[model samples]
Target: MLGASTWNADRAQEIVDEHLSLEAPMLPILHALQEEFGYVAPEAAPLLAQALNLSRAEVHGVISFYHDFRHEPAGRHVLKLCRGEACQSMGSEELAEDLFTKLGLDWNRTTRDGELTVEPVYCLGLCASSPAALIDGEPIARLDATTLGEAVDEARGL
Candidate 1:
């Protein structure tokens, strides 16, 4: 039961039940939980474990192994920067670091004011337009640090 968060156990149980009939239902169940709750509530691991008759460790492993299943609620805006090789070659790493430095954000952390959350994604399929970002789900490519900062600022409405 996710007592402290916006999520509740009843909803978690509903989501688990809805996906239980599928083969290897864990993935779908996790996805549904994230979609409904903004993140997979930590309380959900036990609920899911009980429903699937799995150990909590197994459920937790899947959540940790997958980058998309955010453990905490994201801020009002999300910045998913590409960290794949192609993007790195185009200076995505440096640009991302600059933004992190400027914003005082670490990987998967929200800002102190809860305005933005930045996470790394292995790929956004924008390799051809390397050095890419998805800011609030809008694609911005061919990024220099200044350009990236500008895009982030724009996306954040700053």
Candidate 2:
């Protein structure tokens, strides 16, 4: 686990060294940090700022702006349900409510078991097949209660 303290000068250089050549530098670095550490430790914001020559606020802003960046730990499986207009038009709101009740969770929150998380995604770009969702990042379309339940069960390895 990369502790927050480890994100100081030395690690800043490491982040820069790894992604400086890339067109969008921070993506890889942040992804690496998040992948290894579970979340980007607060210390990373400043270190990334210095390495990227961006203001600390800018670095923090970027992290906060992206839905993928988690300041805290998340469940092993994240269920991102689409909340876009197309989805909502197709009864996604009702679906979302039912999902929350079934999972005993609210949007952007994790279940008590720490195995599943429920999050709202604006769109999955599968709007034509409205009421889409992603289970552990895999697109699932035409979700109904049974399909959603089965997917959630599968995600939990049940």
Q: Worst ten-residue run, lDDT, model 1?
A: 1-10
Please identify model 2 stretches exceeding 4 Å from their true place. 1-13
Indicate the residue-level lDDT of 53 in model 1.
90
Candidate 1 positional error at 23, Å: 0.9
Per-model TM-score versus the true fold: 0.87, 0.83
lDDT of 2 by residue, 65-107 (tens): 8878888867878889999999999899999899888778899
Deviation in angstroms for 72 in model 1? Answer: 1.5
Candidate 2's displacement at residue 33, Å, is 2.6
| 1-93: candidate 1 lDDT, tens digit per residue | 111247888978988998878998999998888878888889998998898899999889989998788787888788889999999998887
